[model samples]
Target chain A: MNQTDAFHRRIDEALHNAQLRQNFRSALTGIMARRAEQFPDETQLQALRDQARAVRANALVRQPELLERLEAKLTENGIQVHWAEGPDEANAIIHGILERAGAKTVVKGKSMVSEETGLNHYLEHHGIEVIESDLGEYIIQLAEEPPSHIVAPAIHKNRREVAELFQRFHPEIPYTEDIDQLTQSARVVLRDRFANADAGISGVNFAVAETGTLCLVENEGNGRLSTTAPRVHVAITGIEKVVERLSDVPPLLEILTKSATGQPITTYFNMISRPRQPGELDGPEAVHLVLLDNGRSRIRVDDELLDTLRCIRCGACINHCPVYVQLGGHAYGTVYPGPIGIALEPQRIGIHKVGTLTSACTLCGACGEVCPVRIPLPKLINRLRAEAVDGLRAGTAVRGHGSMRKPAEAGVWLLWRWLYTAPSRYRLFTRLATRLRWMTPPWLGAWTRYRCAPRPAQRTLHELAREEGFRNE
Target chain B: MSDSRERILARLRANRPIEVPTPTVYAKPLGWDREHCIASFMQRMQAVRGEVHRIARDAWVDWLAGELPARGIHHLLAGNGDVGDRLASALPASIRLSRYDHPIEQWKPALFNDIDAAITHARAGLAESGSIVLWPDANEPRLMSLAPPIHIALLDSHKLHENFAAMIAAEHWANGMPTNALLISGPSKTADIEQTLAYGIHGPKQLITLLLD
Candidate 1:
């Protein structure tokens, strides 16, 4: 159960599976291509990105005021709000709401927040049968697997694999390899559950402080159904999702859809201002908004760490990450994966727990380039890597800042620094390494396991320059 | 709950960064007139697999009457509005009519299984994205636009906006919000199956725009 062991085991298994590698490769390649096509005008895309970054930054700067305004507006509009500092409290609040409504079964739309809190498992432990309405989510649920990709949770599985999984669970329904048939099969099953479920839960894409509205963006209508068809609806989100104004929504929404799925707009953009009004024919009679802190408020306090919250959960960074393309989501052994995970997990779980993840980055800068909100993910990952060794920030804030600082590793780095700082020692070391090159082993530790061993150059660059009759200016 | 809320807000207030002013919303305008909006809306809608039919204002019911039976639709759900009421009175008995007149609990099973299609009114249309904005209320309800297999939206040309930002500013949505406001661009779809496009995964299978002048 140790973080390092779990991550290493999952990573080893993932790298050895050729099929999983192909699945991530094909899916990410297609997503990257479509994302490029959507943003054909470079100048316009940059303008939109800047606008989005400013809106998010403004919201974060004024978060406390905006959240108070949001709670007041939502209360005025007839929505009950609750707060939780961690996952346990969040899950408990949701469970209490469902219990008050006397709900036994629940239908859920796609929610990464719910996953972060492990809501499904929590509810099921309390005797609630939860059905996932989103197709990708439903598929993964049937397989009893965590989501592999944020946007496409079931993207790691092929059509044949989905068909097999569906048949294993719902044998009464005929099986077919056709994607349409497979999709329709999920539709038929989840629709039945949606119709009968007593309560619904969903995630918030953007909660507008100006209008006290919770906006949900989705291509499938399941988000609408999950929030509408049931007697009670519970919407949970991180506190950072709130925006300052209604007009702020347009550009953010525009960038989110294009960056997330390369769509002009999704099939449904559902905004809920309140529960059903007096004598309304449909919609949840009671709506609850649970604002989860879960270390985000602490994350907000640090200026450098706060930029990680600017992520819209678009998954563009994930789609464009070369490391993620090779390893996939499951290999990270966390709720979130890819560049965002490497940067965020170490902070949320503490540097001591998952700090090793920071070293996985190639720092190719693709994730930063495609990030709609300009999160500077590579820079943040590099920051985490340093934080693991000896963070400049207070250890009480991030926890275990210098835990990865092993004496051996520290000694090696210190010796290297000592030698490199002086011209005489550097010259002697280079001379000894070049002369001893024939005795160098073909394999090093984990570094040379997947790579060739490094050997010193036959002559230092300074020696070559001297031989060529050139002098330092 | 109160304790947690207070502490969370306190932490946020204490650690909040330097204030940055909200930037002006930057949405590219189509810079086109009504005819251009219609053409652009149609082209974009069609590109996303939406069916756009330019019908005369009074001929929508007649067109619906002819089209429902041709598609073998036996039961249809409509709202309690002008067009919905008109369809109820005019359609033949062969095509059964269902209204979202009562709370969904009254006929949850029928609404989920029996209805063949649903028709709702559009408050506005975005020309750039080929999307219809629906303000669902007591009479129409949210599921009327989402639950069924087919979504037939009646859009008026006079209600067209250049884009989403234009619609928000013109309508003064910042002043007030609805129970549910929706922007539907096309039918339900997903590429989750190894990135293969499949329609009608959990929502409507088709999105038909009855554009009226």
Candidate 2:
């Protein structure tokens, strides 16, 4: 879909649904409030952010070495490590694993990687019965929709609707409005499936290269069950999810939990090195780690764009984002959403295709402030805009921008072309745009919906300081 | 199979390039306070619908008995400790009491929802976030701290730490890198459906932490 069309359609539908808006508002408020009380001071959070970023940076810096060590260690521990270079290869490797296992039933934990690979649709097409064991995931699975929120998959749902949805599956059950009763019902149902599942699919929260251990964090015990109850446990993780060492984890955990859910630490943290050995009562007998490159190696080589890889998918940026709050996740038209999604989906799919996704941001810097790894999401969005502009000039026609040749549009295009073609023209355009602040028409106002163009200053700060003879001072 | 811990500690702790963490300075208005910090933490939990109370150490057992019947609680699967035993003794003769000493799968259902409530003693409480950290042991199979619908935790006031950093340091001292550690703030909650605040979506619906004097 065209990015603008996708954004408009999803946002319109989501806005009409009062319940989802309330869910998102309530969840974001709860997380923000708890985080505020927990830290009360911004300094601590910033420190945590720095440390977590460093941990990931260290891991990525030693990617080749760590990947080799991780594969070797995992294989020694009776776990198969498969390297997948792209989406097709990743999906094929996973499907091959299931086919060889002859897996009829698969219980899944909340794995964003699976969403990235569209694993469930692929597996189901192969005749495997896949059940999303996570309560939120299960709700969406029943509704036949994608997750609108990362942390809370069914954030777009309401209790009354969920109660009605439950009724479809179990008619005999009473129409209980109580949340506990509904959760209990889900627990009972998923527990039975977990006990009998032929294979369990999971996503890695963090993979420790030093020990070849994969960490799964959850508030509910379902993740543990998903990884342990089935004979085979399959983890689909992106190549960038790896951390260099175990010690690098504590600081990351501290930031991840607080940033994700305002918790000091999640309820259950399972670090699995290998499947259970002979005579062990629990844990999968066979373990497989699918290392998916899927555009990450290409992303890493781009120095300006590489910061997006530092994201932990904590959803902090989304929760804090004003635009995301109003539009919701579906508007992003991709697996990831919010500020990070704005930067990532464009890169993953195509910048020209997802141009509107990047343009829809407020540039409030809230996403950057809350980011655990400090990805500078707003800056990335701006860079994506520049890329989209370049892509359009390269004659790779996108849907909306391709057709937008109005006088104003053509004028802006011609201006950028001249600016790039001549530095003096660029300086003159910048000065002219700076002086024309009052002339921004309503259509331009739409482009600046979430942000002001910062009423362009009378003079550049550097130029003003130079004129004031304050260079030395 | 290699223990990931041994390898991690070896790599990060040995031949490590240590970058000292710079001191954090917050504005005076945001300076920390012990009581206010603790109360703020409790307020966060309360905002999510979890309850908090403070009682004299000697009155906890009696308090549990009085609160249990009002909530229609009967069967109890409690952590093994001096306080848990006292609470278990207060239950009616007809209400079954199971003392946890090891990981038992059959007891999960009873702990999760079949029972009225489960009471356990927490390792410590962090005042900064109003969070209670649980250390897994033979008597606490990790699930006991979570599976139950109603979690009634006992915390001696002395066990409370001023902040998360203090709590983390304390934990490192008590247990050498916990196999599993849980830092529970309040009850289980979600805002999944239509953004409505839903309590007890997965974890405990009601988390009652009684800070014992």
Which parts of model 1 have CA positions greater than 4 angstroms off?
A391-396, A431-442
**Alpha-carbon error at B93 in model 1, in Å?**
2.9
Q: What is the DockQ of each candidate?
A: 0.84, 0.13
Candidate 1 lDDT tens digits, A1-473:
76677778888999999999988787777788888899999999999999999999999999999999999999999999999999999999999999999999999999999989999999999999899888899999999999988889998998888999989999999989998898888888888888999999999999999889999999888898999999999999999999989999999999999999998889889999999998789999999999998878888877888999888999999999888999999998888899998878888888778887887799999999999999999999987777787723554456568888778887898899999999899889888888788878888999897999887777777889989999877
Clashing pairs in 1: none
State which candidate has the highest TM-score. Answer: 1
DockQ of 1: 0.84
By summed lDDT, which 10 consecutive residues of candidate 2 chain A come out lowest? Answer: A396-405
Who wins the lDDT comparison?
1
